[model samples]
Structures are given as C-alpha cells and as structure tokens.
Target: MRKLTDFEKQVIEQKGTERPYSGEYYQHDVKGVYCCKKCDAPLYRSESKFNAHCGWPAFDDEISGAVKRNIDADGRRVEIVCAECEGHLGHVFEGEFLTPKNVRHCVNSVSMVFKSALEVVAPVKKTELATFGGGCFWCTEAIFSTLEGVNSVVSGYAGGSATDANYRAVCSGMTSHAEVVHIEFDPDVISYESLLAVFWQSHDPTTLNRQGNDSGPQYRSVVFIHSDKQAESVNAMINTLTKACVWQDPIVTEVAAFDGFYPAEDYHNDYFELNGEQPYCKIVVKPKVDKVKALFAELLKSN
Candidate 1:
C-alpha cells in the first residue's frame, strides 16, 4: 500500500473536506482511474467525473462497489466512504440534475490518487488468451479485469455469422453473436482452470440466452475455446459442477470451438468502469462484482 500524505490523512481518515475550487482535480481533466488514497482500491473513473462548479472535485459516478453510502451522523446528508477500507470520501447528492445521471458525488481530491490507464495496465510476459460470453460483456469484463494475472479484458462479439458485427447489429438478436470478452492473462500467475472456475461462478449458466434484464442471443452463456485442450477442460469442469449439483437447473453453458472475435467499439471496452453510476451498472453489475471480490479475494490484484 502507498503511504498517505498528511493532507490525504486529514481528508480520508479524519473526514475533513478541502477548500472549494482549491483541490488539484477540480479543474483537471485526465483519462485515468481514481483510487482510494488509503488502500488503493479503484474508486472512480475520469469519464464519470464532471465539473459541478461546487468547489471540490465532483463526479457523477464511481466504480461499482468501490464506495459505500451511509446516512450522516447529523441525520441529513449521505456520507460516502471507501468500501474496501472505510476511508472517508465526502458525500453523495441525488436529483441535482447536474448531468444525465442526475447524481453528484462530491469528493475531496486528497482522498484519491490518479493513475493513468497506461500505468494501470502492466506489460505482459508470455500472455495467453481466453474468450467467454456470460450475459453482458460489461459485467463479464468487469469481473475478469480485476483478477491477479489478467493483463487486459476487451469487450467483443463472438460466435456470430454476421460479417459486419457491431453493437447495433448484434443487439438486434439476428447476428447469432454473443457479447464476449477477450482476456489476455499470464498463465504463470493464474491457471486457466482458475479462470474457468471464475466463469462458472460469476454468472448463471443455466439460463439459456438471458442474464438479468437483458435477454437475447447476444447475452448467451458460452465459452469459446482456443484449443482442444481448453474444450476438454471446460467439459470436465462442467461435469464436476453438474455432479455437485451446483444448480438445480441443468448447466446450459455452451463450450464451442474458437471463432473470430469482433471487438466492440471503444466506448464499450470499460463500460462498468466508466458508467458505474448508471442504473444498469449500479443495479446489475455492482452486486455481481462485489460477489466476485468476496469469492475470489485470493485471486485479486493487490495494487
């Protein structure tokens, strides 16, 4: 963990607020991730931040499950804190109409440290690829991206016949494509079997072509294996899970040969990271991410 400065200690530990418009990030615009100063848990993304002209830096969203909300001791406003370390993070206000999200997270700049995306993604040594589709790529990507050995997770469409596969074309449910994530990881640090375990636990494979509110062929549960060995491994895991009666419903997750993967547009690469405050991310993605963190705490990156 990084050592916190006195100012950061005051704001994050003592729950003090910075002077209005005085914080460094108030007028700063940078594409990166804002992590908690105390524990380095990712808190917010630069894209969700907006100028609220409220003195302190303002964000319209936070990384899913990164911050927790509680009523103030005074019983008036809501206080936000880092979910991982319980460090103070200022407050949250709703219905302000400050942005399309209609929410504002008034945060003290000292409570966070910014890391550009380039710095966050480390260079890989002999990386391997894994592709999977479990409902929405937004949720799947968010889950796998936090794992210890994962180098990158790109949202994309796979197993489709459509030559021109795009979000709009896939969403129409006629393209036969399922929203998938192309993961690049280091096998030396994390085994493919471990990744397979995460895949089974992260989403319900029994549900045919649906996950939560979003339902279509694009949301199907699938594992696109890159090799024959991968296929055998997936089948073995499925058989074990089935014998264990992990779910009352029969396992329906598809294990198929590898196919071409069409990467989604740039905006979709980090959907949960960028739009976590949005209703879909908040309601659908957050809980699943929290569960993954709890279940796979040993596999997560330290930071």
Candidate 2:
C-alpha cells in the first residue's frame, strides 16, 4: 500500500552489481509473491524462480499475462512493464541466466513488492500454469483443481486453428480444438510427470473421441506436449505402457507439440466443481472422481 520498508529498501536498491546478496534475485527463496512495486500487479511466483547474479530479481518465468515486455526505450532492450498499468519494470537478457530456458528477466525490485505468508502459500500472489484436456474442458478442469498442487485450472481449447470458437463450433467437431485445462501448480511438491500421470489416469484415454458417452472429435484422446522433451517423455510413457500391456488396444492419444491454446467461454470453467450437486455433477463427475480415487490411491492425500 505504501513505499517499501527500510530492509526492503536495501534489498531492492542498495545492492551492488558484484556482491553476494547484492545481485541476489531471490532472497526469501522458498515461496513468496512478487508484485509490481509501482501498481502492485502480481508478477512472479517463487517456484519457477532461481537465484541469478542479475542485479535485480531474476526469475526463470513470470505469471502469464500479469506483466508484459516490449522493446525498451533503448530500442535494443526489451522493456518489461506491468501489464496492469504499463509501469516500467526492467529489461530481459539472454545467455546470462541458466535454467531450462536460459532466459533472464531483470526486474528492478523497486518496481516490485513482496508478500509474506502465514499459510504455506500466499493465495494473493502467484504465477502458475498447467494445461489438460479431459473431454469437455468443463469436466476436465473441474476434477483437477480439487487436487493439491493445482493452483488454477482454466478450461480451454488447445491445438487448434486460427479463429474464434464456441460450444457450437467445438461441439460441431470442426474447431480442431481439444478441451483443455491450463493448470498452475507448485512444481517443488509435484513434478510435471506426476501431473501428466494424473492426466493420463483421470480420463478414459482408450476412447478414441470421447469420455464415457460423450463422443466427437472434440472429445478425442490427445496430449498436447508443450516442449520437445515433454513430447519425448509422454511418448516414452505411452510406449512403455504399450509394452507393458496397460491398455488392450494401442493408445490412440495424439502426441504433438502445442501450436496454441484457446480458452473456452467463461461459463465452462469449474462447471463440475460448481455444479457438483447438479445432475451432471452427480451422475457424471462424482463417479469419475471415484474412479480417480481408486486408480490413483498412491497419489491421494493420506488425510
């Protein structure tokens, strides 16, 4: 609400370029929120973050759509700005930080604020993303978000062509979109493989283009891999399962890198979670939840 306190002042502005804690991007280190110091727009989460010698908060990634970047005033520099209010944040550099992407976003801490947590997670701040398609994003997103490590699961249409689509178009089986859930999770506690494993088990992958009675190309069994390694990993898992005779029939799941993911209409998100008491919720989602609990007993919370 107000300017940062004195200790905050030192961390944000007092550090020199070469000192140990001087250029330290992550001080609290475990888990915290990184927000715009100017407008308080929530920016980075601590999970995808790593320590960099960069003279500002160096993160491997940002909370999607919270902040944005454009070529800076220097024209050569890519300017990072608060997507909420266009407040100047900092610049992005490459070949400097080391991580999966080898990218660094050098954001001035003066441009950011931090939040402390009484809970393990400060719900007020996060930068999280996870995607899944469980036949009708409504059903898919509803099931996943109930589990731990899942922060936000948005229903969407992914791996599609250019243009807008709605329930009519998607249901028509012409949009080339798979119903998906963009999930955000705490990676430290759960690995991507675990999420993928949950995804594979959650829905009936044996069905060619449907879940339960739902049928159509829109309901097809597909896993959109976001990275090359993800493609290899998922493919390997499928191959291993095939070799082990997991499914009597070959897995017809489509494995491909994502070109794009388009979110479904607002009404679709949390359909099962909200409508759990409704007919579809009781008849459809509840039974599915039971199956997941039985199949994934190892993954279930002990409590």
Candidate 3:
C-alpha cells in the first residue's frame, strides 16, 4: 500500500477535468478489480468494465460493498460514498449499455485507482467552439443548424453598420446586420474547411446584397473569421472556389476581421427547431435542411 506520488495524483485530477469518459484511463485491460484510492472499497471488478471511451472507467456494475447510492444535492438521483469509509464517488446511471444489464456505472477514473496489470493511455478531447455570421442571421443560422459535429447552433448578428443592432433595423438592411450562428463542434470529427464548404453550398454568396430569395444587404454573405488560422483557411477555400469558378458570379463572401459577436435574443436562437411549422421555416429553412441532409449526411449526428 504505497502512497501515490504527486505526479500520479495530478494526472488523476487532470484526467478528471477533460471529460467524463474521454481519456486514456479506461484503456486498461487486466485481471484486477478497481478500488477506492482513499479507502480501498471495491468499486468495480475488472470484468465489468467495458471500452466506453467516455474518458472515465466504465463498468456494467459495481461490487455491492464498494459503494453507496443516494440523492445528490442537485436533487437528481445519484450514487456515491465508497463503502470502506464513505468517500464520495460519482453518480451511476442506467440505460447506457446496448447489452443486457442495460446500464453503465460511469465512474470517475481518478476517484478510484485502477489495479490493472497493463498500461493504459489517458483519454483526450478534441472538440472546439466557433462563432460565425454570414448574411441574414436568420438564413445563416438556419443553414448551419443541420451540420454534423455541431453540438448546438445559434443565430445572431455580428459586424455591423451600427452597434447594438436589432432584428428589425437589420432586416431593413440599414444597420448592416448579416445573419450568423454560433456553432459548437468537435474538431476531431469535423473540420472547419468542411464547415466552410457547407457554408458556401448552403447559401448564395455570389449575391452581393442577398442570399437568394431573401433580398437585402443584411443577407449578404460573409465569413467572420475568429482567428488567423480560420482566416487563412477561409481565404484558401475562397481562392479555390474562385479558381474553380464554383460561383458563376464570383465569390462575394467577405473574409473580414471579426470584431465581436452578440448573442441574439433567446427566442431567435434555434429558430428552425423552435418554429418548424412556421411559414418561413417551411419555405426557407426546410429546403436548407433537406439539402444538408442529402449532401452532408456524413456530418450529421444520429437522430
């Protein structure tokens, strides 16, 4: 029963922060049961663990004496308290397994030290967040809502003829508002260039003051780049599109230095999901969704 070194403890804590089940901690495959580091209460038998890739060690079930279950402070039903001395462990949930027991004991890897024989790598996270605006925040917003790796999509206005612009004046095409969406994405799963490709295909950037059918300066196409790399990637794609004559009229999409982005009112967020039956959604948004699903099904999350 040797004490863990400082680095080992740090490793555990660091792995805990990355993601619940996304680290190398769970790559272990040996014949030893995992137990509480604090009190050595057997939390899981090695045979029960499976390759979940959630960054945490996952098991089909835990040894009965090794843990306790209780209601958490959030009022959500949870499991915790190691049996030996009642050390606080994380919660347990049901229905994750596709197999028989139909449950997963999603334990924090760091909380209990693994006693496996083989070496295991820590899991890593490879997701990124980005904000973008094209034109007609409504149109751009609606278009990106359908892509893959897109955890969530939100519409808002950015870069303007005026600060603190609203949907009305921007719709008037006077406040110089172009539609936009903030996208949460996983970089390991999708690339920004692919998203750019979707952006170009989803809207008519060739139109200077509009995005086909939605005529107005507010609806103009633009790429509000978040960083130098994003700017370079966007510019490279624009160059390729220009050389290839992807747009008959000429690429009007501007790669402007992104100053700032403002989140739109709550109601404006996820307009397509919220107002699926609305007339604009049916006519404008639905077609975009259909096109994305047909052309970019590989990038979408499973329903």
Candidate 4:
C-alpha cells in the first residue's frame, strides 16, 4: 500500500470530493489502466473513461468485481469504493443515458494513479528504444509521437562529446549535439526497420548538417543505433535508398553507435503540439508532419 498524501486522505479515506476538473486524470486520454492510489489494485480501464464534463473522471463501467457501491453519508447519492481496499472513489449515477450502459461512475482522479497499457502488459509486449536526429527535435518528436506502436517520444540531444548539453549550447553549434527524438516503442507492433523508414522519409537525409532553414550541426541527420542488428538494418536501408536514387545528392546522414542522450528543456518537449498556432510551427513544422501522416497513414494510431 502506498502512503496517502494529506489530500489523498481527504478524498479516499474521508470521502471528500476534489475540485471539479482539477484532478490529474480528469482529462487524461492515454491508453492505460487506472488503479487505486491506496491499494494499487486496478480499478478502471482507459477505454471506460469518458468526458462527463462534470469536473471528475467519469466512466460508464468499472472493472468487473473491482468496485463496490455503498450508501453515501448524504443518503441521496450512492458512493463507489475500490473493491480491494474499500478506498473512496466517488458516486455512481444511473439512467443518465450518457452511453449505452446508462451508467456513470464519477471518480476522483486523486484516488487513482494511471498505468500505461504498455506497463500493464509488458510481460507479453516488450518495448524497445530507437533514437534518431532527423532535424528539429520538436518536429521529429511530433511525427513519431503519432505512430501506433510508439509508447513515448522524448526530445533530446545525442551524438555529442559534452558530458552536459543544453539547447543553447547545442544551438551554438559548439556542442556537436544533434537535436534528436528518443522513442520507446513496442517492436511487436512496429518493427525497428519500420521506424527507420519513417526517419529517412521524414527529413532530407542527403542534406549535410541542416534541415530546411534550420542549419547547424545541431540539426544534422544522424542515427544513434542501440545494437549491431540495428546498425545493420540502418546500413542496409541506406544502401537500398541509395540504389533506388531516393535523393539527388549523396546521403550524408551520420550513423553512430548508441552513446548517451541529454533531454532538452521542458518547454521544448511538445513544442509543435502545444504551440501549433505559433508562426514557426505553421511555417516550418506542420507541413512536414502532415506529409508524414499522409505518406504513412497505415502506421498511424487510430484517433
């Protein structure tokens, strides 16, 4: 059992309600399971989540035998609690017709913690890492983040000698770091070779140390392969692209052995998604993102 924070105790133990729409899981949409914050027992599946717009996380159903209902202290509302630990969840309402189920389990986000589907099913679905520097980490991160099997995409710097590298130092072109996106993906769903294809197609690998107007060593086209098998796959793909004359100029993409990666500043993490209305994203990032979505529609996650 996890130690409950003061606020968690207020909600889970004392049966107090959290502020509407203020809970962490109120707007969360990641594919995962939400477990009891007190006992760590699974309580809700992500698929069961819905936008009740009532400021609390709402679900039409609960995991079978996972939740129990009891008369609330007010006697007017029925309260739901974790079946495993009897920790307070929230109220359950019926006959609202929100879904075919006609049921809504209004839940407190603070009473539960989310676990990604990958984490829940890791024993059967192992994940792998792939890192690439196609251009701006912002652009690369956005592109791969939309893929189906991709679990997470992190914007970072790779292929640098410095023990510590920051965006400012790398952008100065003195750090030798290239803006990169570190990807965690389920190889069973999307193979490493499939990711390499996207990396090659997403940017002009032929260009030397530059992508579009973004010029500097920091913007170089590079791959930091984690294994010899990965190295072989990349080399083979490069050879195939060269033979097919995919690009007019010689491919200058640097393929290096996996070293270390330094994550970029927090603000740069989801630049395109968070700041899509910004001028640079509209002019520089959106088109590339759209092009990849169109070209690789089959590989994308279903919305």
Candidate achieving the largest TM-score = 4
- Candidate number achieving the greatest lDDT relative to the actual structure: 4
Q: Rank the candidates by lDDT, best first.
A: 4, 1, 2, 3
lDDT of 1: 0.90
lDDT of 2: 0.71
C-alpha local distance difference test of each model: 0.90, 0.71, 0.70, 0.91
Question: Residue 130 in model 4: shift from native, Å?
Answer: 0.5
| TM-scores for every candidate against the unseen true structure | 0.58, 0.56, 0.59, 0.60
Residues 16-37 of candidate 4 have per-residue lDDT tens digits of 9999979988899999999999
Q: Against the correct fold, how does model 2 do in TM-score?
A: 0.56
Task: Give the least accurate 10-residue stretch of model 2, judged by summed lDDT.
Answer: 11-20
Overlapping backbone residue pairs in candidate 3 total: 16
Clashing pairs in 2: 37-111, 37-112, 129-183, 130-182, 130-183, 132-181
**CA RMSD of all predictions:** 14.3, 17.1, 13.8, 14.4
Summarize candidate 2's per-residue lDDT along 1-303 as a digit string, tens digits. 447556544533342123334433445575677877656768888776676764457777889998777885557978777788666666777876388788887776566767644433544544345566768676677667766677778777887774745677888887788777777787665667777777787787778888888888888878777677677778888888889888777788887677777777887777886677898888887877777656556765542
- Which ten-residue region of model 4 has the weakest summed lDDT? 294-303
